[model samples]
Target: MDANDFVEIDGSYLEGGGQALRNALSLSCILGKPVRVVKIRANRPNPGLSHQHLHGLDLLRDITNADVVGNVLLSTKVEFTPRTILDNTYRVDTRTAASITLIYQMALPVLLFAGRSSRLIVSGGTNVAFAPPVEYMQQVLLPNLKRFGAGFELKVQQYGFYPRGKGTCQLDVQPVAKLNAGQFMDFGRINLVSGVGFCAGRLPVNIAIDMQQTAQREIHRLWPEQECTIETVKHSPEKTRDNGAGILMTANTTGGVVLGASALGKKRIDGHVLGSEASCQLAEYMRKEICVDDYMQDQLIIYMALAVGRSRMRTGRLTKHTRTAIHVAEQMTGVKFDVTVEPGGQTLVTCEGLGQLNKLI
Candidate 1:
C-alpha cells in the first residue's frame, strides 16, 4: 500500500471511546478507504479492544475482505485495508455477554452498500448496558433509517443476557444505490406510548409484568389523556442463555415523531425503579424541543454524511460521541457538518452528503 493510501485516526480524539474505532471502521469499509487507528479507546478504564470491540472488527474485516492487523482482544492499534464489500450470510458469536446490537449497528452501514443483500445470525447479549437493545433497534432506529431509503428486518431468536450470554438474532439487509436526505426537524404531539418488558432464564415472568406495569403507570401519571400500553415477554431458559430482565419503551407522536428509552435490569438495581426511569426519560426527551434523541442523533450522523442531498437532524444536545462521529465521518469522506443552535435550545446538524456509490454494484 502507498503511504497516502490510508488515513491514520487517533482513537484518543474527542470521545476517545469504542465508537471512534467502530465509526472509523464503518466509514472505511463503506468508502473503501483504508484506515489505521491507534490507541483504541485510550480514555476508558480498559483502553483497548475488548471482546465486544473485537467481534465487530472481525465482522467488518470479513464483509469488506479487509486486511486487518492487530485484530485481537486488548489490542490498542489497528490497520484496516478493505478490498471490496461482499454480500453473504455470516454467523458471528461473541460467546460472552458482549453487545450484539453494537456489532449490528457498525456492520449495517457497510452491508447496506454491498454488491447484494446480506443476512446475519449473530449471538450475544441483546439487552446490555451502554448499548442499544434489540427492541430499540427494531422500534426506533430501523424506522428512522427508513426515511433515508434503507431498511432492514431484525428478528430475535433468543434473548441473551449478561454473564453466560449466547443469545441469537437474525438481520436481513438489502443493498440500495443511494440514500435520500432525512429531515427530522419537526417535533410533534405524542399521543401514544408503547413498551416491551421482558425477563429470561431463572427470573419469574411476573417480574417482567411488574416492570411493564410500573412504566405504564408512570407514563400515565405524566400524561393522563395519552394512550399507554406495555406487554411482557416471558422467555424460557431454553430460549435464553442466562438470567436477565429489561424494559424498552417508545413514545410515538401523531406527527411521525418517535422517541425511545430503555433500562436494563441489574443485580443491584430495582426493576420498578428502572421502569420508572425509562418512562421518565422518555417524558423528559419529549419536553425538549429537539426531534432526535441523544443516541439516535449519534447514530444518524454517519448516514447524514452518506446520503445524497443535504441531511439535517435537529437535536437538543450534542454529545462527545456525536462530535467524534462527525470528526471520523469528515476525515474518512468528503463531507462537512454544519451545526447551528437555535434560541429554542435545539441544535440543527446539517451535512451535504457524499452520496457514495457502491462501485461493486
Candidate 2:
C-alpha cells in the first residue's frame, strides 16, 4: 500500500476500546498512509475521543500536518490524511491535562521514523489514573529502549495528577538508523532487579517509604541483594490531587528489559498491597524465559517493524490490542505480520523485509 490508499478500520470488533483508535492514528502517521476509522469504540461508556485520545490526535496532527475530520466528542468516525512527514521539536498542549504519556506514545512512532533529533514539551497531567505515568516512562520503558539503540531523557518541570491536571515534561530524543534485534530469553545473572514507587501531590513521605519497604522486603525474599527506593514530592496548591504512586522493576542483563506494574487509586492507598501486587506481576514475567508482557509487546512492535532483518520475540498472549496493531500495520504497508502461539503458551511474532522501508526515507 502506498501513502494514498485510504484504509478502513471497524472499531466495534472486540471490546471496541481506545486501542483501536490509537493503533489507527499511529500507523497512519508512520506509513504516511491515510485511514478512515469507523464505529470507533462503539462499546465504550464515554467512548470515541476522550481527552487523552484527542490529545494524541492533536499531537499527530501537529507532527504530520494531517487533515482530520469528524474528530470530536464521542464521534464514531474519523478521516486522517498526512500531508507531510514528522520533523523535530514539536509541542503538544493537552489543555485538559490528560496523560502526557499516551500522547507521547502516539507521537513517538512518527518522530522515530522521520526525525533526526526531536524535542517535545508536553503540558498536561503527568500522573493520571489508568495511564502510564511519567515515573514508568522514566524508569521502566526508557531504560529498555536504550538497549535497542534509542536514547531519550525526560525532565519533569511540574506535577499534575488526576482531575487537577497541570504539569509539564520535556523530552529530548536522539534517533537511530535501526534498532538491533537481540535475545532476552534469560535475564543473565540477575545483577539487579528492584521496584521503586514515587508519591506526589498531597501524599506523605511515609506513604512512599512504607511502599518501598514493603516492596524491598518482598523482592529481597524472592531474590536477595536487590535494591529499592521511594521518592516523595510536594504539590502546589493549584494541583489538587489526593495521592499517586507508580512501581517500576528494572532487571539488568546483557540485553535487558524492564517490566512495570502500577496502580493509582483515590482516597484509599494501601502501600503494602500496591508494592506486593507490582512485585508479583514482575516476578511472573521473570519466571518466563521470554520477554512477554502487555507493555513490552506493544513497545517492541514499532522497533520490529523498523528493523532491517527478521526480528522475533516470545510474548504472553496475542491480545486484541496486539492483533489490532498487526492489522493496522498490514493495512498501511501491505506487509504481512506472522504471529504464532506455541504449546508452552508463548507467542512468537516475526517481521521481515523492512530494509526497503528504511531506504524510503
Measured by TM-score, the strongest candidate is 1
| Model 1, position 196: C-alpha lDDT score | 88
Q: Candidate 1 versus the native: TM-score?
A: 0.97
lDDT of 2 by residue, 254-278 (tens): 4465566665545677767777777
Candidate 1 C-alpha lDDT tens digits along 1-361: 8858779899999899898999999999988789999999999999899999998999999998889999988999999999888999999999988899999988999999988889999999888888999999999999899989999999989888877778899999998888889888877778778998888777788888788888888877877888888989888767874778888898887667788989998886466887887888888887784678888988998899999999888887799999999998899886999999888888999999998876767
TM-scores, all candidates, are 0.97, 0.87
Report the poorest 10 consecutive residues by lDDT, candidate 2.
Answer: 352-361
| Least accurate 10 contiguous residues by lDDT in model 1 | 234-243
Q: Which portions of model 1 show Cα errors greater than 4 Å?
A: none
